[model samples]
Every structure is written in structure tokens, then in C-alpha cells.
Target: MSERITLGKTFKPHWVWAIAFGSAIGWGSFVLPVEWMDRAGPMGVIIGLWIGGLILSLVGLSTGFLVKAYPITGGAFTYAYLAFGRKHAFLCGWFLILGYAAIVALNASAFALMIKFLVPDVVKVGLLYRIAGWDVYFVEVLIASAVLVLFAWLNIRGADATAQTQFYFCVLLIAAATGVTAAMSFAPETSFGNLLPLYKPGIPSWSAIAAIVAISPWAYVGFDTVPQAAEEFNFSPAKATFLILAALVVAASHYSIMILATGLAMPWLDLVDLREIWGTGWAVQQVLGTAGLAALAIALCMGIFTGLIGFYISCSRLMFAMGRAKALPAVFCRLHGKHGTPWASIVFVCAICLLAPWFGRSVLLWIVDMSAVGISIAFIYYCAVAYRLFKWTPTQRAPAFCKETAPGKKLIALAGMLCSIGLLGLLLVPGSPAFLETPAWIALGCWVLIGLGFYLTLAREYCNTPKAEMDRLILGHAAA
Candidate 1:
């Protein structure tokens, strides 16, 4: 087996937390509340977020345990490799790569969309061909492409630069969110009356709540990024585990606060009819005028930028891990000598981001929804791996987070697996509220087929190798 090229350890403890938090929150904090409330009602969304958080916390515990046991770059892929083997690990990595790449593309499209909202003419300046009912603009595509290149360049500069940028952006995101929440709370327009009816007249409350819960994984998706960079964290394995949980708590709190503030600021019925409700920003503007909106927009733009950066960090690392395993082209595993960064992988992701805007906003959204399904599938595998690890591994070699061999720990893992399975089923089953449209489902199916092709080719090449040699080749000696 060839020696694996490893990523540098440049992410400090705080930076680890920042990446996880920033990635988890994203633009969803600002935009999702309106839709969440629309579907689930104000109180229903809050309760749904809380329930979702609790369920994800169990998944986080499993992830933390695995990170401590094997602090490697692949995150879920590494765990799956150890628990199952090469073929299963490749499948896990393939799905996760799709999930992370889809998010990066989603953020790129969002950056263009947000700019269109703030300055409408830029998107219309130079018209491009339309796609899927939405107009494609040349300038909008240019902006998205430029932003993608800028962030990809930053990542290629090295992990230290990426970590520092993430830390600063996260701080700005938190401060801006706090300021908006405070302003909304004090405004006379903000009233609990807006939250009076917990559900819409015709919609069943249970269905509404279930809808939010079904998409909850999207809200907490980035927490696993911490584990993706485990080998690059400049800290103890235990601290890395703590950082993952801390990021989840921070992200959940941020989502809940934003949703509550948006609800208090305006009546649900008033905003329900509009295609998009500016929500918190509009509420603040009603009281404080243009200045408040300006502040909120700046904060939101910052949030979007941070999200793009966070996901770039994650997807690049995933590609790097897969490349080292020979499941992908080895070019992806090569580091820039001076920068100590995965230049090829970062560039590959940026190229995808650059092309995403041409598909238009509606198509991009479908991709994002499909990505959620991919993430849920990966989570189910993660939970199963955690259960097997805890049940069979010796205490001395088990993750530090798992204090003792107990039935309760095993149960948590089981619950996480079952919950993830239920969520995946909700997304895939026809007629479920969470079921994606035909096109999105088709896109996801095509992506999986491509991954399978890659797996078959790689498996054939390694077929003649001994089992031990194959394990070393696929899992990497560093992880073992």
C-alpha cells in the first residue's frame, strides 16, 4: 500500500467549533424560519426544532465517540471503513461527498439570490438563458463564480487561513444575529399575539410538526464537519468531541432564537400569502426603518459567506480522504507544497459551484432538498457504525466519550439509527410531505449510479490483493 498524504493540523480548538457552528447555522437561520413557521406554525416550528435538536444530539454523541476513537479526515467514511470495510466505506463517502457538494452549490446559488434581493437590477443586467421557470442572468452567474473562486482560493492558501477566516465570520454572524434578536424583542410591533395560533386552520398539527422534524437534519448537518477535520485539529480527541456537541448546541439556539424573533415581529397570516417574507428584517424595518434593514442585510450576507466557506472546507476534505483511499482520482489527494492544502479537491468543488447558478434558483433548491436525503442516508450508516463499535469493541480501545459499557449508550445509538431511517423513509416515500419531486429524485439516482461505477472499477483493481493489504490500502495506515 502506498503512503497516504495527510492534511496539516492547523485548526485550533476554537476554530474547530467555529467551522462546525458556522457551517450548521448558514443562511438557513435567516431564511428557514419563515418557511418553517409557514408550514408548522410559530410554536410548532419551535417545538419541532427542539425535538429535532434532541434527536440530532444523539447522533452527535455517536459521532463524537467515533471521532475520539479514530481522529481521521474522512469523518463518517472513516468510521464506516472500520466498522464494515472498503466497499461500504466508499458508499458512505460517496453519499457524504454528494451531500457536502450539494450544500456548497446551494450556498453559491443563495449568494446570487440574496444579491438579487438587495440589488434587483444586477441579476437582470445581462440576461442569460432561462432554466426551469427562473431566468438566468449573466452577471448573477459571474458573481456566484467569483465568490466561489475567492473562497476556494482562500482554502487553497491552507487550513490556518481557512480557520482564521471562519472564526472571524462566525463571530460576526453571532453578533449580528444577537443584535437583530435584541432589536426585534424591544420593538412594539413585536408581539406574542402573532404566535397565538400554533397551527394553520386546515393543516393537521402532527403533520406540520413532522414536516419540520423531517428536514431537521439539514439544520444540523454541518456539525459533522468537525469530525471531517479531526486529524487537522490541534487538540486532544476529547476536546474535538466537545467541539462537535458545542457547535450543535450553538446552532440549535441560533435557529430557535431567529425563528422566535421572526414570529414575534409579524402576524403569520400576513406573511403567509407572500412568496417570501422578509420576516425579521421587515419587522425591524417597521420599527427602526431602513437602518435596521441595512444592518440585517449586512449580517445576512456575512452569514451566507461563512456558510460557503464552511462547506468548502468540508467537501474538499472529503474528496481528499477519498482520493487517499484510491476511491477517487489520486489528484484529489495531492497537496499544494507551500500551502499544504488540497488544491485539486478545492478547485473541483469550486468548479461545481461555478456551474450551479446556470441551473437557476428553483433547480438549485431541488438539489438542496435531494442533498438532505443524501445526508440522512449517511447518518443512518453513521448511527449503525456507532452501535456496532460500542457493542463489540473492548473498553480499553473504545472512544473516551463512551465512559462505560451500558445498555443506555447502545439504546441511544439504536434510536439514532431508527430515527435516521424514519427520516430517510419520509423523504423517499411517495406522497409524504417531505417527498421530493421527480426531477430531484432522478438527479439523486444518477449521482448514486455514477458513484457505483467508480466503486466497481476500484474494487476490480484491488480484487487480487489480500484482505489485510486491501484494508490498509483503502482505510489508510494513519487511521489504523
Candidate 2:
């Protein structure tokens, strides 16, 4: 917790944007694009994604405002502390821990699934007991473990190295995706006609779109990672909002393009019914053959790699920030001396990820899918902070902490809050299109119990500490 031990400030604007975009676009765009199309047809998916993106933009706006105001590492954790206090900050950070670390593990797990598809039974050796129907393989577990170690090492090397690497990987991932998209558009075997029935039959069109929109909380999760790195930026914090907004725009477009590419490659209706574990990959391979497969393989690897690296940067930073404030073990604040990185926090995340593949992919999917509820909770905190801090009467000037309180800012914050509530309802309310399944509910219950145990321990330890000390550690010079 020494002030001298800090994360290195080496991230540039594009590097920050890369971390946001890459983290957001990872494994899902490749594996789930066709699933999204099947649930909600091509147009339905795109429109739903944009609508989600637009709403997430409002959350991003409030998040960015606070990023500039606090200019710190913990993102929502620190934001909640500034706006509320210790209990609320811990509430925000605990859920965020599940959401962020689960994604890093998801990306690692995805690498195994990708290889299994490409090699076909080569790595499916040594069948382990099935959990939730996903056959856990010894070789697959090792593959995922290797990915976890690789990215963990990269993050331990420091933010500058990790962020720059993520930027390059982002370039490769987007280029490969665009290449396949162009190839699909011009291929003699494909046509726009295949994209008909833009909305899935059987479900009402609005319901179909709602299904996609409901998951937008998960879809656009990465853009918020930008704020976690605010303390490590070499550039002015004023640019943080635009950088996050731009990354979100690209993320939405990337998702839309992938969905379109999947539909364009084959008849959407027929392709969805085809028995394939990865419909998007299968569609691309069918249309472009080996070349498409190779390009897409590159995209998948880069996407997963970038995701692992980006989230490693964000998740570890969150722990480091929390530890610095004694919300977590103070050991998490320790950094690698030579690299000036949060090595302890990175290792903690690595340890969690290493054990994840053993649980098998199905359980991981249930856990990861339920992660949306956690992130939506974060969105509620951020916008609620914005609404409370910025909604002063027009005749009165806004507080010093609020740099920009444009007209209707209050309404925008309210809309963002309602949108977040609506998303939570979709996931938590029974019979909603995106309601949590039984397994996901069980997973969420476990996480809540675990977090409660930790929080009570921290509370007992910090109960006697003065509020001013907590403020100084969490907000630094930004403490009011």
C-alpha cells in the first residue's frame, strides 16, 4: 500500500482503445455470432446490438465522466467509493471481480474450444467426468492453462508491454475478420438472399430483438475497462471519454459485421439448424474453405489473446486498487519491482483462471453468461453516481467534481439507470427472454455467498479506521 509502489503510466490513447475494443470483442464474436443470428435473425441481431450499444453509451458517458474526475485504477470500484462509501464500493468491486475474471477465464477456455474445432479430436484425449454435459479433456485443460500462463506473464511484464501487445493483436483480429467478411461478400457461393427472414420466425420480432438487447450488458462489457487504466494513461484524462466511446462504436460494428458474415456465407435458416458447435466458424469455412478457416483461425487466436491480455490488465488493476484500500488483502497491491506491474493481482487472477477449465465449458458458460447481471449492477452504480452528482438545478452551477453537466444530463443518467434495471430484469426475472437458467442461478448464488464471506471479514478489520483514511487511499487527490 505504499504510495511509491504504483502501476506504470505508459498507455497511449490508441493502446487504451485497443484494450477496450479487444476485450469487448473476444471469443463471443467468433463463437456466438451465429447463435445470436439464430436467436434473433441477422437484422434483428444488428439492430438489437446497436440499440444495446446506444444504451451502453449512456453508461459509458457517466463512467467516462468519473474516470476524468477520479482518474484512478479501480473503475467502478473507485467511482462508487467517491459517490457512496466503503460498503457500496465493496459491493461494486465484488460483483465486478466475478464479471472481469470470469471473462479472462472464458477467453482462455475458448482457446481450447477453437483448437478442438480446428484439430478435431486431437486434443480431446483422456475424457474426464462430464459436468453440465461439456466433456472435460485433460489436453484441453492443459491448453487453456497454457493460455492463462502466457497472458498472466504478459500482464506481469507491465501495462505498457501488455497494452501495446493488445493494440497489435487488435489490429490483427480486425484485419482477419474484415478479410473474411470481404471474401464472403464476393464469394460466388454466397449472396444477400441467404440473409432473408431477418427476424427469427416463431418468436415475435420485438421479442427476438429483446433477447439480443437483454445481453448487451455482457456484449459491451469491455469498454468500461478503459476507466480501470485511467491511472496508467500517459495522455490527458480528458480524452478518456472519447476513447471509450470510440472503442464501443467499433465493438458494436465488429459484432454486426460478424453476424452479417455468418448469414451471408449460407442460408441463415438452414445454417442455424446445422449441427455445429461453432456455427459462425462453420459458416465461414463453408464459404471460403481453407483460406477462410486460416484467416478466421488467426482472428480467433488474436481475439482470445487480446481478450486475455486486456482483461488481465483491467481485473488485476481492480484488485490492486481494492487491496491498496484494504478491501482485499494488501498483498494484492504489491507490484513487480523491475516491471512496475501489479504482479500479485495478476497471479491471483491467473490462479482463478487456471482452475476454471477443470469445471468444464458448460459450467463456465453458465457462470460467464450470468456475469451480465454483475456488470449491469456496475452500470447502475455508475449512472446513479452521475445522476446524483450532476442533476443540480439549471440555475445553480454543478459541483466541482462534475466537469460537464449538459442539459438533460440528468435524463440521460436516468435513462441509463432504467436501461440497466431493464437488463437485470431480463436476466433475473422468470419467463423473460433472457432469464437465468437453473444452473446460472445456482452459480450466482454461490458467488454471492463467497463475496459475502469476504466482505464481512473486511468490514470487521476496517470498522475502526477513519472514513478520511479510506477516502485518501481510494480517491487520492480526487477525494472531496
On lDDT, the candidate that comes out on top is: 2
**How accurate locally is residue 128 in candidate 2, as Cα lDDT from 0 to 100?**
83
Candidate 1 lDDT, tens digit per residue, 112-221? 76777767875678887878888888888888888888888988887888788888988888888888878878787778788768775578888888888888888779
Candidate 2 regions exceeding 4 Å error are: 1-5, 394-406
Deviating ranges (above 4 Å) for candidate 1: 277-280, 392-406, 462-465, 473-480
Per-residue lDDT of candidate 2, residues 227-264 (tens digit) = 89998989899898898899899999999888878899
Q: What is each predicted model's overall lDDT from 0 to 1?
A: 0.79, 0.87
Query: Number of clashing residue pairs in every model?
Result: 0, 0
Clash count, candidate 1 = 0
- TM-score, candidate 1, is 0.93
Q: Local error of candidate 2 at 102, Å?
A: 0.8
